[model samples]
Target: MTAAGGGAAGEVDEGPLDEIDRLDAAAYEAFMSEVYDALGGRGRDLPARELHGGLVEARGAVHRAALTAEDVATVLDGSLVEAIESVGRLQTQLGAVGFTLAREAAVRGLHRDVALSLTDWLRVRCPWLSTQEAAQITEVVKACDSPVTAQIGDAVRDGTVPLHRAALVARTMSRLEGSLDVDQREAYAEIATRAAGRRDLADKDLARVCHQLVEDLLHEAAPGERERAAQELRSVTTRRVGPGLTRVTIDAPDGVAATINGVLTSSLAAPAPVKDEQGQVLEPDTRSPAQRRFDALATTIQRGVGRPGAPPSTARATVLLMIPFDPAGGVPSGPATTAAGDYVAPRQAAEVACSADVTPVWLSADGAPLALGRDARYATPAQWKALAVRDGGCSFPGCSALPQWCDTHHLDHWARGGHTDVARMALLCGRHHTHVHQHDLTATVSGGTVTWHV
Candidate 1:
């Protein structure tokens, strides 16, 4: 099949080709020959029905041949990976043909003549196609027929782009109708065409790119439109897979996703060993990453719901959120990045900061710390280390919560005529801290030991 730039699909353009380019040309030639041989060089000369029937026959022949693992080892020069790729490539090309045909059917008004909706009409001939798949094809054809995505459609027809990639580009472009300018639309379509030629990217990776691109564009939409679009996309669903197993699926915009992931990841800790009353070694915790995440989420939810014994916060105080701000430009800089390098929208980051006990660190253009904002009353790292060593754990009587799980509480009440000093502070779990405040309990520190009077 011909590519968009007057060359065979996968052929290198005229240039001083590198070794990788030469390898790509050789591989493409081999792939083309393999595809041609697989089709018996009929070259679309036969009727559509006959060609399809021949394809089915060929598939049956391969199935009946019943090539074993040993035969696979002996076949060609080595393994069956090449066979898989050849078949997979042909499958992708044939799938693109269906989309091309759908576009033609749409333009000819065949669905109208049959008095069926385009989706139903397409599904009538291809009963295996799901309702969603049929609707997607109809949408793709409509988008391709439009002037905005005409070039993308042409690439799909010429076998330069896969149908699935075209579908993603079409869906994204359709949502961005009024939001994008002519140049933007053209550039986006061109990008999609180029992305289609990237054989290295899997469909899922390409889908992510499409989603991110659409999200960035959505940010530029008219006021309230971006929020509306985001709200429409956000969803959560739960289903019971078995008696004791449940599956929860969450879909959200990037900002919300980032926050949720941050909260979950921050809550995660290595499972402690189950100990006997003597504090002797016992069975080690054996939770998988997914199980740990589930526990963290459950714990977070319990705290959010004001459960009696739940901690107010599970995240560490040291989590750094790096979001660029431009005071001079007075415009949004870019997405915020978490300590874990996950991206969060700046607006969401600001929302998080509103209620969070955040200590902002101002930085210069070169990222040197200019100042720490309002941290005089907070514990320093050295102070925290000293307290952790001194307290051994939460200072509340009979509480086994570790220092990492506790916060520094001022025994003399920092808000009520008390100074910030290690001598007057004790490590307390969230529940006990709240309890102490509610009951006006007193604590005495002597010889680096704390005694709480309930």
Candidate 2:
């Protein structure tokens, strides 16, 4: 039977449908051209609608292609890398534009028209954005509003800097505001953003830059102020991130961090050789580095819980504080610093010296080591006992290790003319003992007081 109003069922005229499709394609082409024009050659000015449209088009194309892993492999290695990088760059560019628009919208009070605040509006309209992400964008927007940091925002919008780095710079700049004037802040911001633009610079490197700046500023602060700041900055927090998983966050000064890292990286913490019950070789450890570190931490904690006043079961490590003194005045020339470069105030150093094996080092005005305290290779039992009495535990800053868990370290290397006398020695934990050697640390003792120089 013939179908009603058609030659056959499921049949339709092709000519008019083809014309309609051609018109739709032309209209889409025109819209995309407008979008590209707005982007200014780098996708930097993509409006929300255009950006969403582009994403939709790309998604549709990807779905239509239905490419397989084999198809992906057909591309040359160089092409694949280039394509991946291009996509990443475009995404970054788009993100920058989004941040810029958010800032503009905030400035214009557009959020008040819809939601209570900018972040609230973003959370409401963009459910895909995580809370952290929305907050970060808001922070970026606020930072961009600052005159000093506006250039960093510009760099982000230009796709020259990543969003994370921009945020980091913003935080650093805020911290440095008390130390730097507007001009100095602008200069530092420029340098930071320029460095951020470099593809070779890692986030950690930028962080180091920020750290160095803070340290430099701290150097100009009073000893009491710096010490107080250091004390305030130290923190340790543990939170459960998932079932059976807890994230431990430790924020400490450079010196304390070095000490903690030293312990975690000690030979005792290294991946042990797997052995059978008969003590025969089995296989190398299969645990990841993180897992090994975790196990090492557990073991260290277990070993640290001996009798309250028990001496070490075995020989431990030693520590030394290197403080530079004026040869003429017999006074400290400046504040002492840890091997990791955290400054040590005189009061703190005095506390460490009372118990630490103290060695005096004399330096000329030009920082040349004119003379060192008596040298030592190893401390005698009497000397060790003296140090243990003098220093209750490890002499490293922020360490509370027991004397029994510490070693008698020579302030100066015995091989380099160091003496092992009680006055020239310190008790250091195994980890800090290694740190002293690795950093070639030195210190000074005068009038029963110890001072460390980085």
Candidate 3:
């Protein structure tokens, strides 16, 4: 039959694909019924070996049919939401077909020897698939090993839900293996399947719901069992990826989770952008909440590291940066890099250095002390406090940088007769400080407000 209810030998389906994709409910139901039949049928009583070849051909046909879908520059008929639903249906169908093939191949013991492992066979047959993708299929096969989960296997094959959601069901059931009785787990599997069937269920939400179900099941368990399960759930692991980057994972309980959330929320409470005296953004903060959360973690770690209340052995991690100062003046000639290869602005490094215990080392060209670790250019503690209180934050009019982030700037370039006194001081954050010196911004201090005459 033709696409337009005509006889065969006519043209294939044509027109705006976007329009064709949103066929009425009756037509869609009929088309899905035909697809269901193909998914269930084994072609013409083929021998077991040839059946694999038939399965490959069927997969290719489905792939090609999906590829025929045309992307429209603009929606002409149905809404984009419906188009998205159609894509989901197609993907679920494809996943079901692939999982079924894996289960069949494994069950039939096709080349199930050590020399040509299942992984090897999958790599050869599904050449485009990654190792992880093949491993997921292996997991699905193992999950279906039980007669109890037979319904989940069937639902997955018939595209009642997606592979990821099915995988969640499988994994959740596995976690309950030694904990719950077989009957309890089988009952939970039904909940997983029903939840997975929802069109709007995202993978995260699916995992969340499955996890809650497990927790609910455990709620009725003996106190000792509950405590053991809670103990087993706690974990903290860190894997170093690079010179200074580490990925940390935590399975924190309610109290710890709340503590982390509170710290991060406080970290993000202030306005984001660092501004210049001209009310221009000195640094734009475009980081998302997730990214900001990591930054907050870093900030919290830095703040707590080797502090007063820490263990006696945690005296401090000594950090000494030998920043090159321009001989003509004390201005930093370039960037300052930490021992761990983290490049930081001179002003920002100075802020960290302000709090850290420092034994400054200065060497002349002849390896002599430039001045016994004392530079006349360095501001006194009193001077720093006066600057902080007077300027409030970055002296830039609209900048909301906290005092901790602000650096005391010389109203007159220190290279050109600026004194290290309160009258000669202004406060600016790292970016604005760089801008002021680099662009030679004109400046003045009157009362508590420091004005910049660019």
Candidate 4:
């Protein structure tokens, strides 16, 4: 073991390494070939565990390796271990083909059974494939079985068997399995029964050809005829109801649209109209009959056009009335009851006015209404823009809704005493406006912060 001698310490041990590499390469090729052959078959039989064990042992000889019973079980139960091992070897020969060992293993594992069946069918139908060619053919088959490979499979099953025929065939078959209706299934069953007698075609090819024929026949049928046939073959069910206070019914295709009917007659022992402080009837104080009718028509139009929640477009019929000072003493300016017990505030008035579908009224204080009016000499458009910009959509908490979906809200009650100014005004959607008064929510403006006490 001296230096410069044949058996010296400096001498490298390359023989075993080279031999191991060669044997590993051969083992990988053999494994890949067997996998391809298995996929070509009907895949009814599982790959022998002993064969897998042997391959695993051979792989270990190439690189010191170990596998537990669980690992072996995993591989046997269609895990990517085998594909990983094989692809690793493939990478050595082909310089990293971008396909990862795990990915290749997982893909092959998932489609192993289908691939086996495909290989068997192809072998019977096209027996001229070389060993390497068949492996490549099986790979192509796996690729064509993807969801997007419909046209590829169509070409193959339709008798134009290309290089990657198995892939297209598998994809088409998978698609048919997903989309087949009752009639289609029956047709397929008939075709399958007829094709069972044809010995010339492979079983997979027979199934594929039958599917193709059925699809073509369906496609060639007249559109109306097909629709009628489909309708006849399908069953539909609907619910029925008896008449009630709230009657709802959906009409047939040839009849009227859906309808909801309700009675508007007064309830039993209806309360008499109350009188104001001056003995004037305190009936619902609302817009004129024409205004109400116009509003109803506008609302119907908006709803029909699917814009029910759209904000008011113009200030035409909209009005903001501010009392500035109480007509009578003792009541606060924000929200108070009048001597006649009527809520004379602009917010209340707006609610009553808008109920009849009049223009949206923004009731506020601090001279906000003066600034919001369209006439610049009285209240410039610039002032309105400034107010709109400052409010920044609806001021309702947790509701940063768009300006198109909002209406101006008056912070203080306008009837008792409140100015119509920006300081006392905030933007609120119609829904939030109703919620602030009708619901238990309270909205207040102080120090530029719009606080909503939910």
What is candidate 2's local distance difference test score? 0.68
- Model 1 segments more than 4 A misplaced: 1-73, 76-79, 113-115, 130-135, 219-454
The 0-to-1 C-alpha lDDT of every candidate, in the order given, reads: 0.68, 0.68, 0.66, 0.45
| Regions of model 3 farther than 4 Å from truth | 1-44, 47-84, 110-112, 115-121, 231-454
lDDT of 4 by residue, 1-454 (tens): 4453255587755665466476677787776578668889434344555546756776676464446667756565345666676654543332111112212443556433322233333344446744334443454445444444433323333433433334334433333444455566445434543443344677567657755654574576587655443333232223334554332222222111121111111221123456899988888535554444444544555577663332342234433333223235312235423334445564454343322123222333452332122221121234444556876777765444566566555465443244456676676677667667554354677877788776
Tell me each candidate's TM-score: 0.39, 0.40, 0.40, 0.24
After superposition, candidate 2 runs with Cα above 4 Å error: 1-66, 110-120, 224-454
lDDT of 3 by residue, 106-162 (tens): 888773431234655677678887765666666667678997776677888988977
Q: What is the lDDT of candidate 3?
A: 0.66
Model 2's TM-score against the true structure: 0.40
lDDT by residue (tens digit), candidate 2, 286-323:
88888877787777778877434324312232444555
379 Cα displacement, candidate 3 (Å)? 58
